[model samples]
Target: MKLLLRRPQQSDIQALHQFFFHVIQDTYAKEGIAELVDDQQHEWELKKKYVAMDLESRGEKRFFWLAVDEESNKIIGTIECGEANEIIQQTIKEDLSYCPEIGTVFVHPDYQNRGIATLLVQKILTTLEKQKKSSFCLDSGYKQAQIIWQKKFGQPDFILEHFWGTNNHHMIWKRALPFQL
Candidate 1:
């Protein structure tokens, strides 16, 4: 499918939020944690705030890239690179406030496994490379996503065993810039 990758506008907030909700819901269901409605709501709110910050600050606070289906003009995926999230900061136990953390990677259920997310991440990495960033961090708690990240990023720098609960772990990766795509 043809996709138009671009930074979102103020007018895109409503649609973006809905897109996020759908993706988050699908993700929770796939992870077998759909019953955790509160957690889902929290994640949705956080994503909304991230996009709002990107729009309000004009990408100064958090840079975002959206993948809009060219034919439908609907947002199918999203990715961003910005300040370290709370989980990353707490796990690393250091002041990485100024560091760029690549996250918020969400691809619509219909668009998953189609290389949309990989393209978005590449765009962010290219932009960061131009900015002369040395590295970026990424962390995931979802088992499905963890598998993909592990394949692409190799071993994680840190793994919080049972971080989420029994048999569930949170893995974090800090990769240098100019990485092979």
Candidate 2:
């Protein structure tokens, strides 16, 4: 399908919100964490907040990009870079509040494995480099996503063993500027 990658518009808010839930539910189910309704809701709320921050500050606080199907004009995927999340700060035991984080990378279930996420990430990295940002951090608690991130980013800089209990762990990666896609 033909896709147009661009900054989110005010009109795209509702569609984006729906897209977030669709992707989140699919991800939680795929990861076998479907029973964690509270986690899903928390994630949804965090994404919604990010979108609001992007809209209110016009990308000053957080920059977001949406992948829209050119024919359907639907938000099929999303990615953003902004201030480091609170959890990341707490985990790292340091204030990385000023650090830009690459987060909320999501793609519609129908669009997975099609390089949509990679394209969005490449765009964000390019934009960050243009903004003179030197480095960025990203974390993933989902095993599926951790595999993908490991492939693209090598080993994570930090691994919170059993962060999600049992075999489930959280991985965080920090990459410097001028990274190869």
Candidate 3:
């Protein structure tokens, strides 16, 4: 399938929400937490916020990119980034080593294992490069959603216990931009 990315728009909201739902469901199922939660409600709330932001904000510090399949014109995956070097520094009370933190990345099941996520990550890297940011950090719940990031990138910077403020463990990885000659 042909792959390309663009900033998310109003029309893609529904499909983006649907992709988010499926990814979360699949991830939870992989972690054996499906018995504990069905997160459609959370998805609805998130969708509302996303839509509002799409309407109200210009996404200055935050960048959201969606991967589109050329044939179907469908959004298969997304990368949400936050410009929070200072805020992240305050939260954990440490030096911020990375620029934008990868807020969320969810690829549809039909698009999984096709390197769509990697392509999206590369797009995000390109965006960061334009912003003159050298590296980015991403973290995920152990719910099988993180395997790809860990597999493709280096080992995580660290892991926190019950990081979701629940039983979930969070692992954070740093992806560095390739050196330009």
Candidate 4:
């Protein structure tokens, strides 16, 4: 499939919401947390509101990019930049103090392991580098995402054991922006 990454537009709101819900629901199901599906749906709705607010602000406070499958004209992935969440800020403390965050990364389940996410990360890193940012922080509460982040960035700088529940931890990573992608 031909993939294209571009800034999100007003018209893409509904599709973006569906994309987020689909990915989140699939992830929880795969993790055997189908019982949390309703919670995930609620979170997605809140996230949609946040994205809409960001869009209305014209990206002054946040920026997002969507990966589209050119053949089907559908959104398959997304990445965004913004301030670190409260959990990350509290855990990373002085290390990530005021650093901008790179997050909201998700790819359609069908497209996993196909380098779409890597492309999104590289694109965000390149964008940050161009803006003269020296580093950024990312946090994950999902085990699958934490594993992927560990492989890409080494062990997290901070870990909150059993943050969500027993055996479900949250991790925060701080990395210097590479000069070259």
RMSD of each: 1.0, 1.1, 3.6, 1.8
Worst 10 residues of 3 by lDDT: 83-92
Worst 10 residues of 4 by lDDT: 91-100
The Cα local distance difference test for each model comes to 0.92, 0.91, 0.69, 0.84
Minimal lDDT window, size 10, model 1 = 90-99
* Model 3 score (lDDT): 0.69
Off by over 4 Å in 4: 95-98, 179-181
Q: How far is candidate 2 from the true structure (C-alpha RMSD, Å)?
A: 1.1
Task: For residues 100-134, write the lDDT of model 3, one tens digit per residue.
Answer: 77666778878888887777777777777887877
TM-score ranking from best candidate downward: 1, 2, 4, 3
Query: Comparing 1 and 4 by TM-score, which wins?
Result: 1
The TM-score of predicted model 1 comes to 0.97
Can you write out model 4's per-residue Cα lDDT over 122-146, one digit (the tens) per residue?
9989878777778998898888899
Candidate 4 residue pairs in clash (backbone atoms < 3 Å): none
lDDT tens digits, residues 19-122, model 1? 99999999999999999999999999999999999989988899999999999999999999899978888888876754689988999999999999899989
Every model's TM-score: 0.97, 0.96, 0.78, 0.92
> What range of 10 consecutive residues in model 2 has the weakest lDDT sum?
90-99
Residue pairs with clashing backbones, model 3: none
Ranking by lDDT: 1, 2, 4, 3
What shift in Å separates residue 25 of candidate 1 from its native position after superposition?
A: 0.3
